[model samples]
Target: MKHGRALTITITLLITVLFAVSAGCTGPVQQPSASPAVTAPAADGSSLVFTDQEFAFELRRTIGASYAGEADIGECLATASRIQEGDFESWYTEWNRTADAFRAAGDGSLAAGHRVSAMEAYYRAATYYRTAEFFLHGNPADPRIVETWSKSRDAFRDAIALDVVPYEIVAIPYENTTLPGYFYTVDDSGISRPLLIVQTGFDGCQEELHPYAMEGIRRGYNVLTFEGPGQGEVIRVQHIPFRADWENVIAPVVDYAAGRPDVDEDRIALWGISLGGYLAPRGAAYEPRITALVADGGTYDVGQNLLQNLQEGGGAPANLTEDDLQEWLQTDPAEFNDAILGAMAHDTGTRWLNENGMFVFSAASPAEFWAKWMEFSLAGIAEEIRCPTLVCAGAADHFDPDGVQAQALYDHLTCERDLMVFSDDYGAGSHCQLGAFAQSFAAKFDWLDDRMGMSG
Candidate 1:
C-alpha cells in the first residue's frame, strides 16, 4: 500500500488545520437567511449529460496535477459560474491526487511524521469533496457519487492505519469494542505538555485530519484525536450507531489521557464543530478535566437546525405544530432514520446529510421531519459547561443559529468564555473552511498561549 500510497507533500509541508455549542453570541457577516443550512439540490438532469463534455476539458487540465479542483473552481471564477454550475470531474481528480500523495509520502516509511501528514491530506480530501458537493451539481440519488465517495473514504482510512503510535494507550471505542489509536508527541522539552483532545463534528475522523486538530497542534500542544460512536470510522467500519450518551464515552478517553506521562492534565481542552458543538459542552458537563472548550461556528439547538433543514427540504413534516415535538416522542422515534441511512449510502446525497448531518428527524417522509429533529435537539443542556471557552462562527456559517445559541451556551457556562464571529475577510466556508487553514490554527495556537500564560 505504501508503494501505492498517494500522499500529498504539499498539504503537510504546507497546511494543517472546532469548538462550542450554543456559546451563542454574534459573529461577522453570514449567509442571508437566519438558518439556511446548506442542502444538495437534485442535479440538473438536462445539463448533466454535459458532464462528459465537462470532464473532457477538466481531465485535460488537471490530470496528474496536485490541484485538480482548481480547474473546476477556476472555470467557475473565470466564467461567473452559478450555483451547481461547474464541473466536478477535474475538481474531483485534483482532490484525489492531493490526498493520495499525502498518504504516499508517509506510507510505512522510517519517517513517522509523514504518516500524520498523510492522514491530514486524506481527511482534507474528504472535506473538500463534501464541501464542493454542498454548493450543488449532482443527482441526489445517484449511485456514481457513492462510488466516488467510497474511494475518498478508503484513502483516508488507509492513511489512518499506516501511522505509528507514539502513546502506549490509544483506545478508539466502537460500541462495546475498543481499538487502539496510534500515538504522537512533540519533540520540544517543555515542562508538562498541554493535553489537547479533539472531538470532531458529524462524519469526521479523529486523526486531526480535520482542521481543528491541525490548528490546535500548530499552536503547540500534545493533541490527541479519536473517533467516537457514530463518527467517521465508528460508523463507517464498526457499524456501531450513535447514542445521546456522548459524554460518558468521552470521559474514559479523557481519563486515560490525563494519566499519561507525556501530558499536563491541567491544560486539556476539547474542540469540535457542527454537531460536535452540541456534544462537547455536554461532555464537559461530566468531564471537567478539560480546561478550555471551543465551539467553532456555534450551534445552540442541534435538533432545531435539523428540523429547519427538513422544512427547507420541501418535505415539512405533518407533526410540525406547536405540540408536535412532544407528540412524536410518544410515537415512533426511528421513522425517518432511513433518510440518513440512505443519504450516507450515496455520495450525491451526502451534502444533503452533511449540510444537515447532526440532527435527528421524526421520519424520512415529507411530513414528520421537523418535529422529530426538535425532539433530539441538545439546546437544553448548554448550561452545564464550566470551562473557559471560546465560541466562533464564520460570518457565512451554514449553521445560522450558531451565534445566537453560542451566546446562550456562553451565558450558561459557570466559567469564563468568549465569543468571536469571524470577519467576512476570511472566505472560509461554513463548516469546511479550507481557505482558513493556516489562520485557523494560528488563532487556536495563540489562544492556548494566552490560557497557559506561556509568555516567557
Candidate 2:
C-alpha cells in the first residue's frame, strides 16, 4: 500500500481511448488482465501475480513479532483465503470480521486481568483493521472508512497503554493543526538517545509504523512515528491533502523532537518509507537540522517513473515532455473527471488508482490530481541534502527495480551517503523489502548505528 509512484489519469484515459479504438476495429473488447504483467517471486520461492502480490506482501509485513502473533497469522490467512482478488468489498469484509474477533478477545483478556494477552491481541486487531481499510478508497464519506480506521487507532492506543517501554501520544504543531504521533523509547533511563523521526509513504498510517519503531528502540534509539498531511488521521479526520513541500511537515516534527529531553538533538535522524523515499530527501534538503536521513526504497522522481509506466502500460507517446503533459493536465476539470470515470468503469486498477489518488490529494478531478503529483519529484533538490544519508532499494522491486531511484539519489547527494541494495537471492528484492524486513532492518539500523556511534 506504500506506493512510490503516482497513478496518473493520463494513463487511465489512454487505456480507455485505446480500448475504444481496438474494439471498433477488432470486434468485442477483451477484459484487462486480472494480474499485473510483471510478477515478483515471493520470499518463499513462488511467484505472486496480480491481486496476490499485495496480499502476500502484506502477509510478509505482519509475519514478524513487531506486528503479528501465530494466532494473528492464522486469522489473516483464513480471511485472505475468503476474499476475492481485487474485490474491495470482500477484502474489507473478511479482514474486518477477523479484526472484530481479535478486538473481542482483547477485551476479554483485559476484563480477566491479562494485560499482556490484551496488549498482543489489541495490537494485532489494530493491524487487521488498518488492512481492512486499505482498499476502501472509492468514497471518503463511506462510514466504514472512518469506522475501521478509528477501531485501528483505538486498538493501538490500548496496546500502547500496556507497553513496557515508555510511550507518549504527541501532537506536533503544524500550520494551524497538530499532527498526531506516538513517541516510543526503550526505557525511562533519563538518557539522551539518538532519535528517529519516522514517516510512512502513500497509504500507510502511523499505526503501521510499529515495526520500524520497535526496531529502532531495540537498537537504542528513540523513535517518533507520526501521521503527516494527507496520511492517516490527518487526512481522514483533519481533511488535509498531501503536499510536495515535505520540509514544512518535517520541520515541525523536528522542532517537537528537539524539545524532548529523551531525544538527542545532535543525533536526530529522519526516515521515510515508500513514496516517502522522495519526501525524506526533499525534507532533508531544506531542513538542515537533521543529522542523518534514510529513504527505504529510495525514489528520485515520482513523476518521471509514472510517465515511464504510462508509456509501457498504455503505449502513450514516449516523446512527451513534462510541460506538454502539464498542459494536457490543465484540461477542463469536468472533462477530466468524465474520462477518469469512464476508464474506471472498465478497469479495476484504474478505479482504485483514481479513487485513492483523488481522496488523498483532495483533487476535485483527475486532472487536478495528476497536476498536483507532478511536483513530487526530487530532480533538482536532491543535491541540497547535507546529512549522512542511506538510500535503500530492492533488486527486483516492482516499485523501483535495480535501485533506479536509490542510485540516482545517491549520485545526487553531495554529502556522505550509502546505497544498500537487497537482492532477490536473499528474498528481499520487493519494494521496501517486504518479505525480508528483518534483514532489511538489520542492514538499515547497522548503518545508522555506525553513523550515530551507538555503543553495543
Candidate 3:
C-alpha cells in the first residue's frame, strides 16, 4: 500500500547495464547412475551438461552468501567508483585489465590482495547495472524495466561466475569460478537438473528471470520463476491479487516443482528477489522440505515498510475519484463493490499502479494494510528455515529494505545461513541497482558454494 522499487524505476528497465557479487566449494560430486533426462533445458535449449569446473562454479554461485567471488574486488571497486563518480571511460579501461586478471586467476586460490582486485572488477560492473536502471528509460509499462533488470541480473551472475568475491576480496575456488557455469555432470539424457524455485519481487514476474534465471539454466538448473499473486504479470494480466499468507501461496509452487520426477527433491531451493526475499523465507518457514533458500534484498516487515513508504508520501489518499466507486457499486456488492472500491483507490504507489482494477501495487484500502503487514513479518517464521540459507541486501539499496530485514534474518539462522549487505561503503548498488546487484549476487553464490563444500 505504499511506494517501493516500482516508483524508483525512473520509468524503464534499460536504466544501465553490467552489475555483480560470492565463495567456496568442497568436494566433487560422484556421478549418479544413468537414468532419463528431466524436462529441464539448458541455456542452449538442450539437455544439461557439466564439466567439473562448471559443476563447481554452478553450485558455488547458487546460494548468494559467498565470501569468495570471481572478480578483483579492488579493481571492481575502482571501476564502479569511476562510473558512479562520472568516469565511464576510466572505469572501462580499468575493467578490461581486471577482467583479464580474473581469467588469469581462474580456478585458483585467491590471496586477499588478489581478491580485492577482483572485487573492483565486479564493483564496476555492478555500478553499470544501476546506471542503466536509473538513467535509461522508456516506461514502467514497457519492456525497459524488464530489459534493465535482465541486464542487472546477468551482471551479478557474471560477477559471481568470474573468479572471486567483490566485497571481501578473498580468493577461493567457489561459485565465483562458474563463469555462468554449466552444471550437469552427465548428458541430459538421464539426469534431472536441480530444482530452482524462483519467485519475483514486488512488481516482478517470470520474465524477470532473464539475467539470473538465464545464468542458472546455463549452469544446468531447471528453474521455475513465477510471479506471486499481486506481482507484475500475475496481477496485471492474470488478475490474481496479493494475499497475507505469502508462504502458503508458495507451498503449492514447491509441490508443483517437487511433483516433477526430474527435479532432485534434495536440491530444491527457493530463490526470491526484493519482496520475494520475505516471501521465500515465509514459504520455507511453513514448509521444511525446502533444501536451500536464497532471499535477496528482502523486506523483513511489511507493516513497517508499508507505513514508512506511506508516511514518506505525506499520507495522502489514493488517486481514485468518488464517482468511479458509485458506478461500480451498481453491480453486486460482494465482488463488484470491492472491485470498484479498489478501482477508486487508484493512487496507490507500488502495490499496484492500475487506475482501473488495480494500479500495480496498493492495499485495497488502508484498513487492510495492518492486517497484511502483520502476516508477512519474519519474526515468527524466519528461523524455520532449516536448509542452508543465503540472505542478501543492499546496504544503500533504495529499491529494497536496505538490509534491515536481511540482517535480522541472517542473525537468526540456525542452519548454515550467511547474510551479506552491500553499499557504496562496500562498493555496491542502491536497492537492486546493477552496481549493488553484482556484488550482492556474487556474495550469495560464494556463500552457497562454501556451505555446499564446493570450494576446491
> Could you tell which candidate, 2 or 3, scores higher by lDDT?
2
Cα error, residue 380 of model 1, in Å, equals 4.6
User: How close to the true structure is residue 95 of candidate 2, measured as C-alpha lDDT?
Assistant: 82
261-322, model 1: which lDDT tens digit per residue? 77888778777665666667678767879788766645566454433444444344534643
Instruction: Evaluate residue 404 in candidate 3 and report its C-alpha lDDT on the 0 to 100 scale.
Output: 46
Provide the TM-score for each candidate, comma-separated: 0.61, 0.86, 0.49
Per-residue C-alpha lDDT of model 3 across residues 1-456, encoded as one tens digit per residue: 232222222212211110111100011111121011111111210002222221212122221222223233344344343342222233334434444444344323234445544443453344333333432221335454455445444444454554321111111121222001112122345456566667765544343343565445544566565556665434444445566577666766666666666667777777777667777877887887787877775556644443334334543234422222222222223432244234323312211222211223334432233233335567666667788776665444433423445555666666666554444443343444233345544556555545433333
Q: Once superposed on the true structure, which residue ranges of model 3 sit more than 4 Å away at CA?
A: 1-190, 305-362, 366-374, 399-402, 425-427, 433-437, 452-456
Which candidate should be chosen as best, given lDDT against the real structure? 2
**Candidate 2 residue lDDT tens string, 1-456:** 111123253555464322100000001111121111113433443223224444555555554333324235566667777878767898899889998999999999999999999999999899888888977988888988889999999998999888787988999998988999999988988688889889988778988888789888988899999988889999999999999999898899999999988889999998898878878888999998899888875777755654665676643465766655555665634555676788777766466656777889998786787778777777788888888888776656654544556677767777888766666665766667665666777777877887788858
Model 2: clashing residue pairs? 35-50
| Model 2 error, position 62 (Å) | 4.3
lDDT of 2: 0.73
**lDDT for each of the candidates?**
0.47, 0.73, 0.44
**Residue 431 lDDT, candidate 2, scale 0-100:** 69
Candidate 3 contains a number of clashing pairs equal to 98
